[model samples]
Target: MKKRWIVLDGSNIMHWKGNGADLATVREVTRRLGEMGYVPCVVFDANAGYKLNNRYQDDAELAKRLGLPSARVLVVAKGTIADEIILSAARDQNARIVTNDRFRDWADQHPEVEEEGHLVRGGYRSGRLWLNLPDEAP
Candidate 1:
């Protein structure tokens, strides 16, 4: 069997508020995925009009520090939507997507792809990100 591929929506994970996620949280998630033997990729939006500094650079640096390949960090350029890029990547790579966005409805329309949504909360448990994996590829 082929290894499962996980594509993460970078913007959603970072929350895109200038500051990246807590290093521990990011490491924990990545470590968990690694232990599960999944190939992980993170995609972030990089439209020229986004008006955010260090968008791609920050993500790239983090990915590098985390030992992820540059190819795994997709920065969508201007005049396009990240969703389109994500969908295309999922279709082309036959990978599973992870995002908190409402793209579940759109993903459900596909018959050959898998998607997982993460619900995160910070509290006594130091926050948790729950992954909702689909019953089957769709």
Candidate 2:
């Protein structure tokens, strides 16, 4: 069977100005998912002059150094929206998406796309993040 794909909304998780806490959280989640053998794709939005002085360059570079597939970490150009791109990619690839946006409601409306909630518990002690998959009736 093909490995499950997890699409992450990089822009949503990073927040404006690239908050450190948010970035750390995202990195932790990504690392954990990799440990679990899940394919993760994180998409971030880039401005017109992003190539000149990009804030996420370090992130993209790190992902590259880690040998992450190019297709899995994308930086969408300006004028193109990240949310829409993420949704489209998920739908096209039949992959599960991870986002805190209500826009996920649209995916819930689709019969083919399964929507689930993620919970990350614990502060300093041993913690775990769980993916709450939709309950399936036998």
Error of 1 at 25 (Å): 4.4
lDDT of 2 by residue, 30-123 (tens): 6666776778887766641143244446446645643577667877766777777877787777776665555745555454344343311212
Lowest-sum lDDT 10-residue window in model 2: 117-126
For model 1, how does the per-residue alpha-carbon lDDT over 14-76 read when each residue is reduced to its tens digit?
542324454344445555566767777766666421423433454566567557777676667
lDDT of 1: 0.56
Evaluate residue 124 in candidate 1 and report its C-alpha lDDT on the 0 to 100 scale. Answer: 16
Q: Give the clashing pairs for model 2.
A: none
What are the candidates' C-alpha RMSDs?
Answer: 5.8, 6.1
- lDDT (C-alpha, whole model) for all candidates: 0.56, 0.56
